[model samples]
Target: MAGQAGRSAGFNKEDLSSYEYKKILCKKDEIKTLEDKTSHVSDYELCEETVNDFYTKFRTNHDTLKLKCDNENGSKCCRDVNYYLDHATGIFKSSILNDSDKNKLIKIVEEIWEPNLRAKDIYICERQTDLDSTRKRSILQHLHDLKEDEDYILSYTKDYNNHLKEKWEKIISYTDSKPSSLFVKIENNSMGIVENYKNFLDSSDYICGNNLNDLSAHDIKISTDMDDFLTTISLDKISLNVEKNLCFNKRYVDMLKYKASNLQRINNALSIGVAVLGVLLIFIFLYEFSPLGRFLRRRTKKQIEVDENANDEIPDSYENSENGIPYISYHSTSH
Candidate 1:
C-alpha cells in the first residue's frame, strides 16, 4: 500500500500542466517580438483574445476577400499556407512559414483554432483577407510595365522591317544593272543541266544495273539536249560536224582494214614461196651428193672425149688420101 501511494505521488497532473503553461508563456513572448516587426495594421498581441478577434473578422469578410484576391499570385499565396497547415501540426507546423516573423504568426493562429474549423481553411482565409486591398494595386502595376515592353517591341519591329526593305531595294537595283540576256541563258542552261542530271539519276536501271556506287564517269551518258547546250550554241551545227567526223572516221577504218588484208595476203604468199624454195634447195643438194649424180657426170665426160678422137682420126684419113693420089687415079682409070 505504501509503494502504491509513492507511485501515485510520483505521477502529478498539475506538474504536467505547469510545464505546458511555461511553454505557452515562452511562445507568447516570441509572438510579441514577431508582432513588433510586422506592419502596424497586422500587429496584434499573441493571445487567445487576439486570435479569436482575427478569426471573427476573417469569417465575416471571407467571401468578399476571396473574390478580391482571385488572381494567380494571391491564390498561390493562399494555397501555400493551406498546403502547409494541411500536412503539419503543433510546434513543427510553425516552421512552414519561411519568414521568421511569419512562424510566430502561424504558431499563434494555430494555437487558438476552434475544433470545428480546420487549420488549412483558417490559414487560407487569413492570406485571402490580407490580399484584398493590395490585389488591385499590384494588377495595375503589372499592366503599366506590360505597356512599356509592348511599345519597345513595336519600335524594334518597325526598325527591323525598314532595314530589310532597304536591303531588298539595293539588291533589286544591283540586279537591274546587269544584262538580262546573259542571266536568261545561264538560267536556261542550268535548268537543262539539272533536268538531265535528274533524268540520269532516275534511269539507274539502264545506267549500271541499279548500283550507283559501281557506276564510273564513263558509264554516265549525257542527255543530247544538255550536250548540245554545253558544246555549241547551234544544235544543228554540232550534229552536222559530228556526222562529218563520223563519216571520215568510218572511211579511215575501212582503209585500214583493206591495208591489213593486203598485208596478210602478201605475208602468206612470201611464206609459200620461201617453203617452195627451201624444198628445191633440199632436192638439189640430195641430187649432187648421190651416186647416180656422180655416174651421170662421168658418162658425159667420156662421151665428150670419144667425139674429139673421132674428129682427129677423120682429119688424118683425109691427109693420107691426098698423099696417095697417083695410085688411086690409076685404079679409077682402069675401072
Candidate 2:
C-alpha cells in the first residue's frame, strides 16, 4: 500500500493544473493587451486562417510546383504545414513581446515572407567540373552566409534546382561517348570509336513511333509530320535486294573502316620493328672487330676467290706449248 501511494504521489494531477493556471493567466493578460491596442478592429482571423489564405494564393499562382511537390509527398505536406508554422511561432513570440502590439508586427511578417526570400541573396551549389577551387570556395562561403542568417528556404530551393540541373546535364552528357581508355585496363589501342550520329539515329525510333496524327495541329505536329514525310519510303518499294544492298553497303563501309584501323596498327608495328632493327644493326656495326666478324670476313674472302677462279678459264682462242704456252689466237677446226 505504501509503494502504491509513492507511485500515486509521482502522478500528481495538481502539478499540471498549477502550470495550466499560470499559462492561462499569462495568455489572458496578453490577449487583453492585444485587443486594446488594436481597438480599431473588432476581431482578427486566427493564425491558422491567415496561413491557410497565404498557402491557397501560393498554390493558385504556382500550380505546377504544387502538383510536383504533392506528387513527391514533400509538396503535399505544405497544405497542412501552414498552421504549424504560424501557430507555433506566433504563440511563442506573442508571449515574449515587450507589449502585445509588437506581436502584431511579428505576425505581419508572413505577408512579406516570399518577397523577402526573393530579395535575399540566393546561393546555388551546382556541381560544375569547370569550377575552380576559388569559385567553389566562394559558393561555399555564400551558402554558409545564407544558412547562418536562417535564410535556408531559398538556399534549399536553389540546391534542389542545382541538383536537378546536374542530373539532367549528366543525362545529356551521356549522349557524348565515354572512352574506357581512362581506366588503364582499356588501352588506347583497344578503345572503340563511337559515332556521333549513333545516339541521334537510335533516338529517331522513339521520336517517330508516337502518333503525331492524334495531336492537334501545332508546332510539334507540323515538325513530326515533316520528319515522317521525309523518312516514309514505301514498304512495297523496299525489296529484299534493296535491303541486301544497304546491308552490303554498311558492311563494306565497316570493312573499310576496319581495314583503315588495321593499316594504322600495322604501320605502328612496322615503325617499332624498324626502330628495333636499327638498334640491332648499330650494335652489330660497332662490334665489327669481334671474333664473329673476323670469321665472316674470312669466309667472304674465300668465296670471292672461288668465284673469280670459276670465271678465269681460258677461251678456245688460247693455244698450248710443250711446258708452258703463251696465249695466241687460233680459230682452226680439225675435220
Candidate 3:
C-alpha cells in the first residue's frame, strides 16, 4: 500500500494520481521512527561514490560472503557497513518520503551503481545460487540458486516471483505440498525461509516461507503456495525502503527497518509492564501511604468491631451486666 488509504480516507482524483506515483507513504507510527533514524546519521552529498558505496554496503551482509577488496587495486576507500550507511543515510531517509524524490533516488542508484554489482557478487552468487544437490553447505535462498532468476538477480535486490517460485518448487516437491513432519523437516532444513532475515539478506533476494510453513489447518497447495506465493510476501512490510527495493542498497535500508522493529517490539512490551506497575504502585500508595488509606483502615476496623458485636451470641442467661444491673436467666437450656 502506497500513499494514502482507500475511499474511507477520502482521496480526490488529483491527489490520488499524485499519491500513486511509485510513492512511499509514512505511517503515523513510523514518523517518530524516521526522525530518530534520520538524526542518527549525517546528511550525505549526492555523488557517484555515494551511490556506489550505498550499493556495495547493501549487497554485503551476513547472508553473503565478504567482498574481496585489494587496498591498492580494489576499492581503496570502501567504507564499512555501519559508517557508510550513516554517510549514505540520505537515501535511507527517503523511505518516509513518497514523491518525485523517490524517482530521483532510483535514477541516482542506476546512474552511479556499477552494473556488475548484483545480489550475488560472484562469491555471494555462488553462495546464493547453490541448490545443495551434493550436500555442500552454503548460503541458500531457495535451496538451489534455481538459475531461472540468476539472469536478473544481480540487476535488483528484490527477489522476483520467478525466483521465489523456483525455491517454492523445490520445497513443494520435497513436501508434496502436503502438511506433515516431512514437510516441516524439509522446510526447516532448506529452500523454505523461516525468519525475517531482511537485515541479513536482500529483500528481493529471498522470499521468507515463514507464514506458509507456520502450523495451520491447510496443507501446502502448489497452485496457491507457488502461483500465489507473491501475495504472501509483502515488501512494504519486509523491505526497509520500498522505493529503493526496486532501486538499490535495500539490505541497509532493510537493516534499519529490522532494528527499528526490534526496538518497537521492546517498547510495546515495556509499555504494558509499565502500565501494570503504575496501577500496582497507585494501589500501594492509596492503601499503605496516603491519609485516605489510614482513614479507610480505621473505618474498616470499627466496622469489623461492630460486625463482631452484632454477630455475638444472644444472651443465654443475661446474668452478667456491666452496669451491675440485676438480670434474669432465660430457660433456653430446658427448651
Candidate 4:
C-alpha cells in the first residue's frame, strides 16, 4: 500500500491538477509518435512531398524576385539547380555537409527520381514474348510479392477486360518474329524504358498484362451513329506515371495550369545583389573624376623622384649620373 501511494504521488507532486497530468501524458505520447515517424527514414512519398513543397516556396520567391528586382544577365539562374546543389543555402552561409553526406543526399534524390526515369523507359516496353524461365520467373515473382487475395491476382493475370483473353494467348505463346528488349519491374514504380507503338502493334494484351500499359493503347469505343469517337484508357497508370515523370516528354501536351499562391516572404534580399553591382559599376565608371581617385592614381612622378633619391648615394647609379640616361654605361674617378 505504501509503495502504491509513492508511485501515485510521483506524478501528482504537490497535488498536481488533472489537466497538468493529462498534458504531460499527451506530451509523452507526442514524443513517441515523433520517434515512430522518424523510424521510417526511407519514406519516399514524404521525402518527395517535402522537396516539392520546398521547391514551390523557391519558385514563388523566384517569381517575386523577378518582378521586384531588376538586374540584367540571368538573375533568373539564381535558384537554377541544373547539375549541382543548394544555391539557396547562402542564407546559412555555413555548411557542415561533407562529401559522403552530399553523396547520400544525391542518392536519395535519385531514388525519388528513379521511377520517373523508369517510366520513360517503360513506354518503349514491347512485350518480350520469348519467355524463358527468366521472364516467367520475373512476372511470377512480382505477382507473388504483392500480398493480395486470389481474386486480386486473378484480376490482373486473367483479364480486367474479359475481351483480352483471346488475342493475349496468341501474343503470350507465339513464335518470336521480333522480341522486345525492354523489361518492366514496377516494384512500387521504380523500373522500365521508352520506344514503342510499332512493336506491340497486334499484341495490346501482353502490354497491358504487365499491370501497366506503356507501348500500346488497349481501348477504343465508337458510337452507334459512327459520328462519335471515344477512347477509354486506364488513367490511373497514366496519372501516376505523369507524377513520377513530371511530364518530361509531354510538357506542352498538358501545359495549361491554374494555381493559388499566397507567397509572401517578409525579408528583402531580392535587390541586394543587383543594387550592389549597379552601385559598384557606377562608382567604377565615374571613379577617375572623383576626389578619391587622386589618392588611387599611379603616382608616376612621385615614384620617379623616389627612384632618383634612392640612387643619389650610389655614384655608379644611372639615375644620379650627369645625363640621367637609363641603361647608359659611364666611368668616373673619385678623389
lDDT winner: 3
lDDT of 3 by residue, 1-335 (tens): 12232223222322322122101221122322433443334333333344444354444431232334333212111212211222233334334434454445445434443233332332222111112221111123222232323444444323333323322332222222232212111222112232222111223444332322222212111221231333332334443332321222333345435666767899999999999999999998999989999999999999999988776755545656667985775456753
What TM-score does structure 4 among the candidates reach? 0.19
Each model's Cα RMSD: 42.3, 26.8, 23.8, 30.3
What lDDT tens digits, residue by residue, belong to model 1 across residues 1-335? 00122223233322332122222222233332322233233323433354454345444333333443444334333432232232222222223234554466556555543222333442333422222222222222222222323333243443323322321222122222331211111111101111222211112111111222222222222222432333322222223332211111222234335556766899999999999999999878766897876887789999999999999876555453465573222224553
The alpha-carbon lDDT assigned to residue 104 of candidate 3 equals 55
Candidate 2 C-alpha error for residue 302, in Å: 3.2
Ranking by lDDT: 3, 1, 2, 4
- Regions of model 1 farther than 4 Å from truth: 1-248, 310-335
TM-score of every prediction relative to native: 0.20, 0.20, 0.26, 0.19
Q: What TM value does model 3 have?
A: 0.26
lDDT of 4 by residue, 119-230 (tens): 2221221222123322332233222222222333344342322222221222222222244433222222312222221122222222222332231221222122211211
The residue ranges of model 3 lying beyond 4 angstroms of the native Cα positions read: 1-277, 313-335
Candidate 2 per-residue C-alpha lDDT over 1-335 given as tens digits, one digit per residue, 9 for 90 to 100: 00223233233222332122222222333322332333333234433354345434443433333333333333123322221223223332433234453455445544443333221122211222221322222222222222232332233443433322321222222222242111101001111112222121122111111222222211111111222322222222224323221211232235345556766899999999999999999779855967878888889999999988776755434555545765665669999
Local distance difference test scores for all models: 0.34, 0.32, 0.35, 0.30
User: How many residue pairs clash (N, CA or C atoms closer than 3 angstroms) in each of the candidate models, in the order given?
Assistant: 0, 0, 5, 5
Candidate 4 stretches greater than 4 Å from native: 1-283, 298-301, 308-335
Segments of candidate 2 deviating more than 4 angstroms: 1-264, 271-287, 316-335
Worst 10 residues of 1 by lDDT: 182-191
